[model samples]
Target chain A: MNVALRFDPVRLPDHCQDLRQEVRDFLREQVVQGVYDPTARSHGYEDICRFAKAVSERGWIGMAWPREYGGQERSFLERYVVSEEMLVARAPTRRYFVADRQSGPTLIRYASEPIKQRVLPQIIAGEAMFCIGMSEPNSGSDLFAAQAKATKVDGGWRLNGAKIWTTGAQHADYMIGLFRTSQPTRENRRHGLTSFLVDMHADGIKVSPIEMINGVMEFNEVLFDDVFLPDENVIGEIDGAWKQATSELAYERSGPERFLETFGAMRAFLTAVEGTDDTRLQEGLGRLIAQLHTMRRMSVSVAGMLEAGREPVTEASIVKDLGTVWDQALPKELRTLISLMDYDQYDVQAYRERMDFYTRMAPKLTIQGGTTEILRGIVARGLGLR
Target chain B: MALDSDDIHVATAERIFSDRADLQTVAHDRDGAYRASLWQAVEENGLTIAMVPEEAGGVGLTLEEAFSLLRAAGRHAVSVPLAETMLANWALAAAGLEIREGVLVPLVPAPRGHLAIDAEGRVTGVCPEVPFGREAGAFVALCDGPDGPVIALLDPAACRIEEGTALSYEPLDWVHVEGAPAMASAPAGTAAALPEMAATARANQIAGALERMLDATVQYAQDRRAFERPISKFQAVQHLLARLGEECAAAVAAAGSAADTLSRGETGDALLLEVAAAKVRCGEAAEAASGIAHQVHGAIGITREHALHRLTLNALAWREDYGTEAHWALKLGQLVSAGGADALWPLLASR
Candidate 1:
């Protein structure tokens, strides 16, 4: 039996270029106004919020959502253009990225009408920050192994357990957490888990920052010590989060962020080696650019699929697998490519700093969203091998 | 799967290829008997001249449709010069020349020793690695005309051919033309596009072959047993096959996008970037996939008896045909570098 794999050569819609330019202009203005340093590897908490709010004011966050929720009701392709431009420009999307990308959509789909009316608008307004609580200290890639309990109370669920590696948790206003509501059946190991919209500011929630190798304190160990979540905060069917989780993967895995994490290093390399007549340098840089372009095409194709209301799970996994792997190796590859060339010809300090930051950031690229092993398993299932 | 009007041609090509050019048949035939028959069937099905306009005495099909036919040809692992002939016919028609019947392989001469039109308008110079050159009734050469670039149909009988074969046992000959007689010649404004066209064709073919390889490897993994279970049950084997699937997807996306760009009449740096990136990406995928496909198959895949060679070897052979990955990589790299650091993202996002 043939596995039906379709990439479908999807080009961006004709009007996306205008939207892309609009995003570029807005980001340029941010840079000019000293809002965020494009050259910096990371930003402070206030910087991130200010930038996210500016983007939200432009109606870019949650752009594909309906107008009633403060969204622009734009096409996914338009949103894609906005997201990629923001990523490439190194705009601080830390505050609203998760909400705009996945959490907002999840809330709109599964949150109660009152919860949606309250939270979706806040997400659209960039007044809320969201973090994923799938990974625990025990379960990193194996999301089904989450041991966080959410026992039902009189009018709510009492949450207890720690979620480690929760990115931006310290600053998150809300968390779309996976909590165990029942024991997994022998037939389905992925059962018993339920997704809930946990209020981070609620009592019994403690967020402790986890410092990374790059000396950046981004991810946090979030402990849910009897945190109360009302019935309205429960998202989707109780103990049916597996179905919802898999569907959201297509949106999360295949985005510009998958590949553009090390774009600064590439830009630095280009600046360092600009005007070089050396053949080796050109060839090395060219292959990287080619791969980048191909990855973008695949990412855009996935966006096209999403726009057309098709869940391209397999295609999205493939894109993330290739894109993340390529991005992870890029810093080292660029290092090797520019090692032999004279450093004095370019901004050696800036290039070195960018490379240094990206080199530290590379290992987490594939591990963060979905590890290489997990993504490959998903792809194999898609290929009908398992 | 509803058959759209565009897919109708591709479907017919797929059907014809499966019937006459199935992997078992093509792999088993030592002689050219089966390949000859397959070529005959392909020509009879109007797949040979699909790129030429109907006004020029050939099937008027879009570039996308023609590419799909080539992709189907690739999936069957047919050794016929179908892609070359289609490209040659398209060039001939674009140049307002007569579209000849039979296998007329297009030659993108090596940059240094490329064929040229002399004072008497005859094609001259030594063009090497001319795929299926010996089997061709004529060689479609994009020559350097006195006025501009021109497309010249050179009679293969008049040329001295040094026969060669690729790793796949497909005909890849070197044709030396010392003022060879021109069957037809005309100024082709789009003559510079032949190389990119050829690259796009190879990219599509590589994409198709990769798909075939993935299918074959996945099936093999399922059937082959080890430790009382199918090899596919093993996580290692599944991951290898999954990696192969990723490469196949990348190739398909890159090649399909390039074909679309060419079909939409995009030219200049935009077309160059798309075609070059496609060739580079597909070539890289072929290299990576060929290894994974063979690794998954073990000893049997290396043997000539297995149909795996028919797909992998040809895909690898195409990596060097139009231009090696390094060759296109250099061109693309230079283009990107020349545009400077600030322009790279804009150029990439333009597509």
Candidate 2:
């Protein structure tokens, strides 16, 4: 009956610190080699995928997974170090991020041996990319309301529906898609859905890029017209994906990416304010940095909980809620502080551009993965309100 | 990451607070028995000197254990200077000064305060507001000495004391010193660290108070009916409580992280970053969650008879203790700016 939520202090161990430095050095070297431009603010498929391959060679992708699956079997804290470093450096980890964070782990937990043998190594090796096909046009936040169907066939299920706002779907080699495998019981609307590992290269699958407000083409509309997924592709129990999906959210919703999305803007803001005695600017940066530091602590705590085999669903949701909101506000808050500075004195034109880019990207922060509303609901349920 | 063996301390605190300092008991206690009994229990448990090293004639609990204890005191919104006394003993002990017993309040003179020590080691200064100061047997003052920082244990009987009250009606007294001889004075490194310690302590208390507020508000929402159903069933109410939950989580995380950092013996910018971040974050959370808690509770929440005000008002008052969010935020901002942009991430990731 205690409504207290726990986010225990989870300091990354010495190993994470060592891994962090290596990541920073690697990223710095990549920047020097023109593998990617930190100032460019965005990286395309080729640049990101190549960088992913290099990162994988360092045994970072799926570093927390088992060695038999081409992983280092490192702690989640170590993986967390790699993630936050990639994010802060703007290293375009999109190619391996999903797979490293969730998909590979999901496969390890539930995939068939052949599927695990085939996919996890590719995922760990950074050869394969994965996308989550959860949001249909009508069922973005209301995930259980997804009408995407997968009718049973002789040897598999035939998928027929569409998933919108699927990030990186165009280049995805696989998708952990949620589809209707049975009718919903009156008692439980969430009981009917099933999750499948669909081969993206299948004949009936189609991927169309969708441009976002930030001018990024990462979002996609994936169409499944008779796209067949074999029996082995089913993850865990059929018609019980609600259970798996809920568990997966703890990993997806809490991460450095939730709060560090607009870190570039913050870094630029710091550059602009450096060597200046502007109280307003310093105070602004201080507040943001404080919030950012706290978010990282919370995120790390959740990661530690996961490492210890505890399901910190509520804590993870709270992280995403607070983190996304803070990240979303970073640009707007920076803009106010920037207004107080003399542009010519600070030489902040590039900083201004970074702020603009983050401003456009901010809207989706609380919407993707889990909308703020949905996250709040999850937190509410955690509070025993539901 | 669970408290594990530290659970004994938290559980002890929980037991003590529930028995002697429950909201209703403290709210309506006209005879001051509740406050006195709570203090007695805390003292009996040897919690006041928990931060002082065992070799220094005290319990010598780890800073982490002590903080968890403070947070437990916070859950009941106990309006005593438990944190101040613990911190005072800690500072005195760290300075190798004899630990003072009985209601010891701390005084870390504001940057602008007139508190000073002359060559003769006589204390001359004024602390405009000190929580539980009127009742303190002795005052632990961290001030500038001619050579460096010094920690002085001052006898209240020699100094002028005036009683005041915070918004929560707890004792917020004023103390004046006209070159009063210190009972004991020692050159202390803890002087410079006092503010951060005090702020971190307040952050821990605020985090605890916020958690209690969330608990109370959520309970109230469920029990209070509106439009033919429990108000909690409404999405608006649930979301507000949810946001309150978020604030509580952030506050706890921030405070806990700061406590962990201090317990590890970190100092300088490393210590400043964590403590400043904790104070600022917890202060913000207190302000935010306090309002949401009241909003969810409605008219009764504002009434004196209601216990909700104790938690909310104390949280607000604690937000100003040691340093307000703005105070620490500005300090933190200056620190970050000094490090420059390139060094910022490394500073944050240092933990």
Candidate 3:
């Protein structure tokens, strides 16, 4: 069997250069105004909301969507440039990044017309926030094993289970959640799940904060205690959410955010090594930069494939697999290189502090989204090994 | 410049390779006689001079097309100097020299023997590890001259050839030219940037070879059985193959981007950055992927009887050609360092 994986070289278009420049200018202004700190691990909710509003006003949020829902009808590549710039700048994108990246697109594709009319506009206006509720206490990587049940009621469904590791759920206005609706068949273990759009403000829903190892409450355990959802809130096919779930993996996996999450550490490392004539340090830095460049190229090529209306599931999984592994290892590698340097020679205190935080954040890089093990399994199947 | 999956040139080259240069057949040919016919087939297809202009008495294919063809040549691990010939012809054409009919190899004067040019344009140097230097009829080299760099086409017969072989058993000979007369010489012109060009060529070759390696390893994993099932069913073996896939993807992306950059006629810092990154990244991929491929195939991978050795050994050998990971990494590091810390993101994002 042919196991060749294609990552076609795709250069950003000329227009993307202009868009990138505009993003840089806007980010620079934000930095000067002290709207958010690029070096910080997290931004305040107000800062995130303000920055999201500013970015939405520029027609960047929901950029790749149709213009009917406040989108600009821009290309995925253009949206790619915006997302990468925001990530590199470490902008306060926490409020709307999930909605812009996946939730809005998911709703556009599967939501009812009324839901789209109500939610897409709010998402595009930066007034709405979304959190993904896929992982539960027992179904982190094996998502098909999700036990969050949704039973049919008079006019809607009643959800009565807890979803763990629900990022941004406490602050989100809505959540795109998966609920088990029926039993799985012997042939297809992935059968019987359904997707629902949950209103966070709905009664019987409680979000309990879960503090991470990094001393951040960035995720939560969302408990749905007999929460009633209108029948119209169901997304796509009932007992067939598996189909919709797999289709979005390509878009969600192959993105700039997968690799650029710890790019701030790289920037800080560069600052510490500035003016050093050491060849060893330079070589290490060069290797890191080269790896980053290759990852970016692969990611961009996947974006181009997405633009061509092709679903490159395996290719996108390969990107995430490689990107997450590299990013997870980047902080430790940088730490090793910095450990060899003379401490008094350079002002590396700030960089060291950032490295400490990044080291803590690095473990979650591969664990979040699709774990490395699961991604590798997807890649293996793509290689026809399954 | 997205990779052209349906390029005619690549398809043609693939056809030639699949027909004439099957790895198993070539591996069994201990006498190495299959190389002549394979080289003749490739040369007759006008692939060697594909990068040269038609007006210059060459095939005149675009750089992208030529690199695609080279990538195909690499996938089969054809034991000849196809990439060398292409680079040589490109250098000769850039210097406005006549294209030679037989095998041509381009020599980059660094990390090996040195070459000096006198006022009369006679070349003197001993360049080592020139790929296929012993078999090549002529050599195209960019020599350091009294004025500047000079591009010269020299007869290989005039030089002393100390025959050598790389890990892949390809001809890698050292040539000592004691005041050998130049067949044709001119200002280096575009040929002066031979290091980056060579790196780009080797990067493409490494990418192609890595792809084939991945294919072979995956096939082996599926066919090989353990515990009454295919080893591929094992999660460990599957993950290993997946990592191999990642390395192959990285190599392809780096090399493809560099090829795209070169095809656009980028030079200097832009060219240096891309080519260096490609070489460094692809070289790293080669190192990591080869080990994993060997591990997946077990004992069969290391033996000469199996065809896996052909691709894996060549992948390792190609890492040292043009420039090693360390070599290019140093150059790239210095470049990045010179640009300072604030410029790093913009420089990377500019691509």
Docking class of 3: medium
For model 2, how does the per-residue alpha-carbon lDDT over B1-351 read when each residue is reduced to its tens digit? Answer: 435324887788788888988887777776677788889998898889988889999997788888878887787898777899999989998898888779898887774465788789899989877888888888999878998888988889989988888877788778899999988888877556888889999999999899899988999999999999999999988899999999999999999988988888988888888998899999999999999998998857778678888888899999877777887888999998988889998988888
Cα lDDT of model 3 by residue, B37-64, tens digit: 8889989998888889999999998787
lDDT of each: 0.88, 0.87, 0.88
Per-residue CA lDDT of model 3 for A1-386, tens digit only, reads 27668888888999998999999999999889988888677888899999989888888899989988889889999999999999988899989999998999999999888899889999999999999999999989998999999999999999999999999998999999999999999999999999999999999999999998888999899999999999999999999999998779999999998899888888888888887899999999888888888899899999999999999999999999889989999989998898878878977787889889988878888988899999999998888887
Native-to-model Cα distance after best TM-score fit, residue A70 in candidate 2, in Å: 1.8
Interface RMSD of each: 2.2, 1.3, 1.3
Give the CAPRI rating of model 1.
Answer: medium
TM-score of chain A of 3: 0.98
Prediction 3 TM-score vs. true: 0.97
Residue B265 CA error for candidate 2 (Å)?
A: 1.1
Candidates arranged by DockQ, highest first: 2, 3, 1
Question: Candidate 1 vs candidate 3: which has greater DockQ?
Answer: 3
In model 3, pairs of residues that clash are none
Following a full C-alpha superposition, what root-mean-square deviation does model 3 have from the true structure? 1.6
